[model samples]
Target: MPIVMDVDALMEFLRREFPQVSEDFVIEEVTEELTTVRLAVGERHLRPGGTVSGPTMFALADVGIYLAILARLGPVALAVTTNCSIDFLRKPASGRDLVSKTRILKLGRVLVVGDVLIYSEGDDRPVARASLTYSIPPRA
Candidate 1:
């Protein structure tokens, strides 16, 4: 399927609905099969070890898949993550941005499943991988 919502439209919808997290992430690209999203990591995202925290990476994965689903299904604000499993493979770059490449595995009426690979900017290998399932609300 074609993307129903592009990056700018999706970002606007997110800014209007989820203002708190809107500033941390940017929807760089959106398409039928893939979505590229960026996390503007900051000092607050770091842990005691001077590395990006797991929760921060998890947020990036969740938002990446969420936006991918929205790009395909339009601005469905009620769609929520039903399940998520993330594996942190390597430490993220402290001074660079992080990017997520998200791809849909399944798209159904009530649920969407997708995988996300997060990599530090300019890196070829993923720093983390995540599988996410989202529950899409019924049409009103």
Candidate 2:
């Protein structure tokens, strides 16, 4: 299927619907099978050891998959995450923005499963990997 939402449109939809988190994420690219996003790493995203926090990484994965699903389904604001499994493989580079490379494993009427690999910006190795399942809201 063709992508219903492009990066610019998806960014607008996110800003309009979820302003609180809109600025935290930047949509880099969007396609039917893949989506790329960046997290603007800041002071709040770090932990006591000066490394990126786990929750921040998890947030990136979640948002990446969410946007991937939305790319195919349009501005379906009601889609929600139902399950996630994440592995933290390495420490993220300090003060560098993180990138999430996401792809869909399955897209269904009520659910979409996505896999994500996260890396520090400019780094070649992944810092974490995640598998997420989102429950798409039923159409009216």
Candidate 3:
């Protein structure tokens, strides 16, 4: 599918519909097959061990794929994640921005599937991998 929204437009869409979290994520790259997003790691995002937490990374992948879906389908406000499976491969580096690079695997009328690899910024190894399934709302 061709892209219906770019990085700036996706950011704008998030800000307009989901203002509470729009600031937590940065839309870095958007395209037909891939969408990249970054989370600015703050002290609150760290675990007791001073490493980025799993939930934080999960949120990154969730939001990144949401943008990937929106980029293809426009602003479908009711689209929701039907399922997600994630693996934490390694400890994420501390106090660095986390980046989620998401690739869409399937886009159907009601379901979307995508794979996400999350890295601690500047690291070559992925800290986690996720496969997500989203349910798209039907149009009226």
Candidate 4:
């Protein structure tokens, strides 16, 4: 499917719809097949061990897939996650941003399925993986 929203449009949508965490996320790249997003790590995203927290990584994956869906479907704020499974494969590097690459596995009329792989900035190994299903809201 072609992308209806590019990186700039996605970033604008995030800032308009979700101002609270919009600044933390950067829509790095958006293509027909994949979308890449970056999370600007801050002190709040770190655990006691000075590594990125699981919840933080999950948030990146979630947002990454969400943006990927929106890129193909346009600004569907009502589209919401129906299912999510995440695995923390390895500990994220300290004092670095997190990057997620997301691609849609299936794009149906009612549901969208996708997966995201997250890596610490400058690292080759993925720190986490997530599979997500989103329910697209019915159009009136």
Evaluated with lDDT, which candidate comes out highest?
Answer: 4
How well does model 1 score by local distance difference test?
Answer: 0.93
Best by TM-score: 4
Model 1 stretches astray by more than 4 angstroms: none
Predicted candidate 2 versus true structure: per-residue lDDT over 34-137, tens digit per residue:
79999999999999999999999999999999889888988888899999999999999888999999999999989899899999999999999999999998
For residues 1-140, could you state the per-residue lDDT of candidate 4 as single tens digits? 99999899999999999999999999999999889999999999998889898889989999999999999989999999999999999998888999999999999999999999999999989999999999999977
RMSD of 4: 0.6
Q: Which pairs, if any, clash in model 3?
A: none
- Report lDDT (Cα) of residue 129, candidate 1: 100
Tell me the TM-score of each prediction against the true structure.
Answer: 0.97, 0.97, 0.97, 0.98
Range of the 10 consecutive residues with the lowest summed lDDT in candidate 4: 46-55
Lowest lDDT 10-mer window, candidate 3? 27-36
Whole-model lDDT, model 2:
0.93
**Candidate 2 vs candidate 3, lDDT winner:** 2
CA deviation > 4 Å runs, candidate 2: none
